[model samples]
Target: MEFHHLGVATADASGLAALFAELFDAPVAHEEEFDGMTVLFLELEPGYFELLEPHEGGAISRYLENHGPGIHHVALQTDDIEGALETARGAGVELIDDEPRPGAWGHEVAFLHPKSTGGVLVEFVSH
Candidate 1:
Protein backbone atom coordinates (compact mmCIF):
# COMPACT_ATOMS: atom_id res chain seq x y z
CA MET A 1 0.00 0.00 0.00
CA GLU A 2 1.03 3.56 -0.64
CA PHE A 3 0.01 6.82 0.92
CA HIS A 4 -2.87 8.31 -1.07
CA HIS A 5 -4.07 11.41 0.71
CA LEU A 6 -5.02 13.02 3.96
CA GLY A 7 -8.62 14.06 4.45
CA VAL A 8 -9.31 17.19 6.42
CA ALA A 9 -12.78 18.02 7.66
CA THR A 10 -13.59 21.69 7.51
CA ALA A 11 -16.66 23.86 7.97
CA ASP A 12 -15.39 26.26 5.32
CA ALA A 13 -14.10 24.64 2.15
CA SER A 14 -13.12 27.71 0.15
CA GLY A 15 -11.43 29.33 3.09
CA LEU A 16 -9.40 26.26 3.96
CA ALA A 17 -8.46 25.73 0.32
CA ALA A 18 -7.23 29.27 0.11
CA LEU A 19 -5.19 28.86 3.26
CA PHE A 20 -3.54 25.71 1.96
CA ALA A 21 -2.93 27.28 -1.42
CA GLU A 22 -1.24 30.26 0.08
CA LEU A 23 0.70 28.38 2.70
CA PHE A 24 1.88 25.35 0.78
CA ASP A 25 1.52 26.57 -2.80
CA ALA A 26 -0.95 23.78 -3.43
CA PRO A 27 -3.40 24.18 -6.26
CA VAL A 28 -6.93 22.87 -6.48
CA ALA A 29 -6.91 20.02 -8.92
CA HIS A 30 -10.56 19.04 -8.86
CA GLU A 31 -13.76 19.22 -6.88
CA GLU A 32 -16.62 16.77 -6.57
CA GLU A 33 -19.62 15.67 -4.53
CA PHE A 34 -19.97 12.13 -3.29
CA ASP A 35 -21.95 10.37 -0.64
CA GLY A 36 -23.29 13.66 0.76
CA MET A 37 -19.77 15.11 1.04
CA THR A 38 -18.45 18.11 -0.83
CA VAL A 39 -14.80 17.39 -1.68
CA LEU A 40 -11.95 19.45 -3.00
CA PHE A 41 -8.65 17.93 -4.18
CA LEU A 42 -5.42 19.83 -3.79
CA GLU A 43 -2.27 18.63 -5.49
CA LEU A 44 0.84 18.09 -3.38
CA GLU A 45 4.28 16.55 -3.76
CA PRO A 46 3.78 13.04 -2.45
CA GLY A 47 0.10 12.59 -3.23
CA TYR A 48 -2.97 14.80 -2.77
CA PHE A 49 -4.79 16.64 0.00
CA GLU A 50 -8.53 16.38 0.31
CA LEU A 51 -10.80 18.83 2.08
CA LEU A 52 -14.18 17.37 2.89
CA GLU A 53 -17.10 19.48 3.99
CA PRO A 54 -20.50 18.05 4.65
CA HIS A 55 -23.09 19.03 2.10
CA GLU A 56 -25.83 18.30 4.59
CA GLY A 57 -26.12 17.18 8.19
CA GLY A 58 -24.00 14.06 8.47
CA ALA A 59 -21.09 12.35 10.15
CA ILE A 60 -18.44 14.64 8.68
CA SER A 61 -20.17 17.70 10.08
CA ARG A 62 -20.55 16.00 13.42
CA TYR A 63 -16.85 15.15 13.35
CA LEU A 64 -16.00 18.76 12.70
CA GLU A 65 -18.04 19.88 15.68
CA ASN A 66 -16.73 17.30 18.08
CA HIS A 67 -13.12 17.19 16.87
CA GLY A 68 -12.74 20.90 16.07
CA PRO A 69 -11.24 20.67 12.58
CA GLY A 70 -8.18 18.55 11.78
CA ILE A 71 -7.10 15.43 9.97
CA HIS A 72 -10.21 13.34 9.59
CA HIS A 73 -8.90 10.28 7.75
CA VAL A 74 -5.86 8.77 6.09
CA ALA A 75 -6.25 7.13 2.70
CA LEU A 76 -4.13 4.26 1.50
CA GLN A 77 -3.77 3.23 -2.10
CA THR A 78 -4.51 -0.44 -2.62
CA ASP A 79 -4.38 -2.81 -5.52
CA ASP A 80 -7.60 -4.50 -4.41
CA ILE A 81 -10.16 -2.71 -2.30
CA GLU A 82 -12.14 -5.88 -1.56
CA GLY A 83 -9.01 -7.62 -0.38
CA ALA A 84 -8.12 -4.68 1.82
CA LEU A 85 -11.59 -4.63 3.34
CA GLU A 86 -11.38 -8.33 4.00
CA THR A 87 -8.01 -7.92 5.64
CA ALA A 88 -9.36 -5.15 7.85
CA ARG A 89 -12.37 -7.25 8.81
CA GLY A 90 -10.21 -10.26 9.62
CA ALA A 91 -8.20 -7.99 11.87
CA GLY A 92 -11.46 -6.99 13.64
CA VAL A 93 -11.71 -3.53 12.18
CA GLU A 94 -15.19 -2.12 11.89
CA LEU A 95 -16.03 -1.03 8.38
CA ILE A 96 -18.21 1.95 7.60
CA ASP A 97 -19.23 0.51 4.22
CA ASP A 98 -20.01 -3.12 3.62
CA GLU A 99 -18.76 -2.84 0.07
CA PRO A 100 -16.39 -0.72 -1.93
CA ARG A 101 -18.11 2.27 -3.52
CA PRO A 102 -17.34 5.15 -5.80
CA GLY A 103 -14.84 7.58 -4.32
CA ALA A 104 -13.08 10.76 -5.28
CA TRP A 105 -10.49 10.65 -8.09
CA GLY A 106 -12.24 7.82 -9.95
CA HIS A 107 -11.39 5.16 -7.43
CA GLU A 108 -13.40 2.67 -5.38
CA VAL A 109 -12.92 2.92 -1.64
CA ALA A 110 -14.11 1.76 1.76
CA PHE A 111 -13.76 3.26 5.21
CA LEU A 112 -12.79 1.65 8.48
CA HIS A 113 -14.17 3.18 11.64
CA PRO A 114 -11.84 5.19 13.85
CA LYS A 115 -12.57 2.95 16.81
CA SER A 116 -10.77 0.16 14.98
CA THR A 117 -7.75 2.25 14.04
CA GLY A 118 -6.41 3.84 17.17
CA GLY A 119 -8.94 6.65 16.91
CA VAL A 120 -8.02 7.47 13.34
CA LEU A 121 -10.36 6.84 10.45
CA VAL A 122 -8.66 4.80 7.73
CA GLU A 123 -9.77 4.66 4.11
CA PHE A 124 -8.63 2.07 1.59
CA VAL A 125 -8.83 3.07 -2.06
CA SER A 126 -8.21 0.94 -5.11
CA HIS A 127 -5.42 2.24 -7.26
Candidate 2:
Protein backbone atom coordinates (compact mmCIF):
# COMPACT_ATOMS: atom_id res chain seq x y z
CA MET A 1 0.00 0.00 0.00
CA GLU A 2 1.06 3.56 -0.61
CA PHE A 3 -0.07 6.85 0.82
CA HIS A 4 -3.14 8.12 -0.96
CA HIS A 5 -4.35 11.20 0.84
CA LEU A 6 -5.05 12.81 4.13
CA GLY A 7 -8.72 13.41 4.85
CA VAL A 8 -9.49 16.69 6.54
CA ALA A 9 -12.83 17.69 8.02
CA THR A 10 -13.53 21.32 7.41
CA ALA A 11 -16.46 23.70 7.43
CA ASP A 12 -15.05 25.57 4.46
CA ALA A 13 -13.37 23.43 1.86
CA SER A 14 -13.08 26.17 -0.73
CA GLY A 15 -11.48 28.57 1.69
CA LEU A 16 -9.04 25.97 2.90
CA ALA A 17 -8.27 24.85 -0.64
CA ALA A 18 -7.49 28.43 -1.60
CA LEU A 19 -5.25 28.83 1.40
CA PHE A 20 -3.45 25.58 0.71
CA ALA A 21 -2.99 26.55 -2.93
CA GLU A 22 -1.15 29.71 -1.97
CA LEU A 23 0.77 28.30 0.95
CA PHE A 24 1.67 24.84 -0.28
CA ASP A 25 1.46 25.27 -4.06
CA ALA A 26 -1.27 22.67 -4.11
CA PRO A 27 -3.96 22.80 -6.75
CA VAL A 28 -7.42 21.33 -6.64
CA ALA A 29 -7.22 18.10 -8.59
CA HIS A 30 -10.77 16.92 -8.11
CA GLU A 31 -14.00 18.14 -6.59
CA GLU A 32 -17.30 16.39 -6.10
CA GLU A 33 -20.43 16.28 -3.98
CA PHE A 34 -20.59 12.87 -2.47
CA ASP A 35 -22.42 11.39 0.45
CA GLY A 36 -23.89 14.77 1.46
CA MET A 37 -20.55 16.57 1.48
CA THR A 38 -18.37 18.67 -0.76
CA VAL A 39 -15.21 16.69 -1.36
CA LEU A 40 -12.14 18.33 -2.81
CA PHE A 41 -8.85 16.68 -3.54
CA LEU A 42 -5.86 18.98 -3.61
CA GLU A 43 -2.82 17.82 -5.46
CA LEU A 44 0.45 17.66 -3.62
CA GLU A 45 3.75 16.15 -4.78
CA PRO A 46 3.45 12.71 -3.26
CA GLY A 47 -0.24 12.36 -2.73
CA TYR A 48 -3.20 14.60 -2.02
CA PHE A 49 -5.16 16.40 0.66
CA GLU A 50 -8.85 15.53 0.65
CA LEU A 51 -11.01 18.28 2.08
CA LEU A 52 -14.43 17.23 3.31
CA GLU A 53 -17.11 19.81 3.99
CA PRO A 54 -20.37 18.50 5.24
CA HIS A 55 -23.57 19.85 3.71
CA GLU A 56 -25.91 18.65 6.44
CA GLY A 57 -26.05 16.52 9.55
CA GLY A 58 -23.88 13.45 9.03
CA ALA A 59 -20.62 11.86 10.16
CA ILE A 60 -18.48 14.82 9.13
CA SER A 61 -20.87 17.29 10.68
CA ARG A 62 -20.96 15.31 13.90
CA TYR A 63 -17.17 15.07 13.77
CA LEU A 64 -16.78 18.81 13.36
CA GLU A 65 -19.11 19.30 16.31
CA ASN A 66 -17.02 17.04 18.49
CA HIS A 67 -13.56 18.00 17.25
CA GLY A 68 -13.34 21.23 15.33
CA PRO A 69 -11.77 21.23 11.84
CA GLY A 70 -8.76 18.98 11.58
CA ILE A 71 -7.34 15.82 10.15
CA HIS A 72 -9.91 13.05 10.06
CA HIS A 73 -8.37 9.99 8.47
CA VAL A 74 -5.38 8.81 6.51
CA ALA A 75 -5.90 6.81 3.34
CA LEU A 76 -3.65 4.25 1.73
CA GLN A 77 -3.93 3.11 -1.84
CA THR A 78 -3.93 -0.60 -2.50
CA ASP A 79 -4.24 -2.79 -5.55
CA ASP A 80 -6.53 -5.20 -3.78
CA ILE A 81 -8.94 -3.75 -1.26
CA GLU A 82 -10.46 -7.08 -0.24
CA GLY A 83 -7.06 -8.52 0.48
CA ALA A 84 -6.16 -5.54 2.59
CA LEU A 85 -9.37 -5.89 4.62
CA GLU A 86 -8.64 -9.55 5.15
CA THR A 87 -5.13 -8.68 6.29
CA ALA A 88 -6.55 -6.14 8.71
CA ARG A 89 -9.06 -8.66 9.99
CA GLY A 90 -6.38 -11.28 10.44
CA ALA A 91 -4.43 -8.83 12.52
CA GLY A 92 -7.55 -8.28 14.65
CA VAL A 93 -8.02 -4.67 13.61
CA GLU A 94 -11.65 -3.80 14.16
CA LEU A 95 -13.30 -2.90 10.89
CA ILE A 96 -15.53 0.12 10.68
CA ASP A 97 -16.38 -1.12 7.21
CA ASP A 98 -16.54 -4.87 7.01
CA GLU A 99 -16.61 -4.56 3.24
CA PRO A 100 -15.59 -2.07 0.61
CA ARG A 101 -18.06 0.61 -0.38
CA PRO A 102 -18.35 3.45 -2.87
CA GLY A 103 -16.22 6.42 -1.91
CA ALA A 104 -15.38 9.78 -3.36
CA TRP A 105 -13.46 9.83 -6.70
CA GLY A 106 -15.14 6.56 -7.69
CA HIS A 107 -12.87 4.46 -5.55
CA GLU A 108 -13.67 1.37 -3.53
CA VAL A 109 -12.92 2.18 0.11
CA ALA A 110 -13.13 0.69 3.54
CA PHE A 111 -12.27 2.01 6.96
CA LEU A 112 -10.64 0.44 9.95
CA HIS A 113 -11.83 1.48 13.40
CA PRO A 114 -9.64 4.13 14.96
CA LYS A 115 -9.68 2.41 18.33
CA SER A 116 -7.82 -0.49 16.81
CA THR A 117 -5.55 1.63 14.67
CA GLY A 118 -3.65 3.65 17.25
CA GLY A 119 -6.52 6.08 17.63
CA VAL A 120 -6.17 7.17 14.01
CA LEU A 121 -8.74 6.26 11.41
CA VAL A 122 -7.19 4.37 8.52
CA GLU A 123 -8.83 3.99 5.13
CA PHE A 124 -7.94 1.50 2.44
CA VAL A 125 -8.74 2.60 -1.09
CA SER A 126 -8.56 0.88 -4.45
CA HIS A 127 -8.98 2.97 -7.55
TM per candidate comes to: 0.90, 0.98
Instruction: Give the best candidate by TM-score.
Output: 2
Estimate, for each residue in 1-127, the C-alpha lDDT of model 2 and write its tens digit.
7999999999999999999999999999999999999999999898999999999999899999999999999999998999999999999999999999999999999999999989999999986
lDDT of 1 by residue, 36-110 (tens): 887998889877889998878788889888988889889999888888888888999999987999887688889
Question: Which pairs of residues clash in candidate 2, taking residues 3 or more apart in a chain or in different chains?
Answer: none
Question: In candidate 2, how many Å is residue 38 off?
Answer: 0.4
Model 2 residue 40 CA deviation (Å) reads: 0.4
Candidate 1 at residue 109, lDDT?
Answer: 87
Worst 10 residues of 1 by lDDT: 29-38
| lDDT (0 to 1) per candidate | 0.88, 0.96
Indicate the TM-score of model 1: 0.90
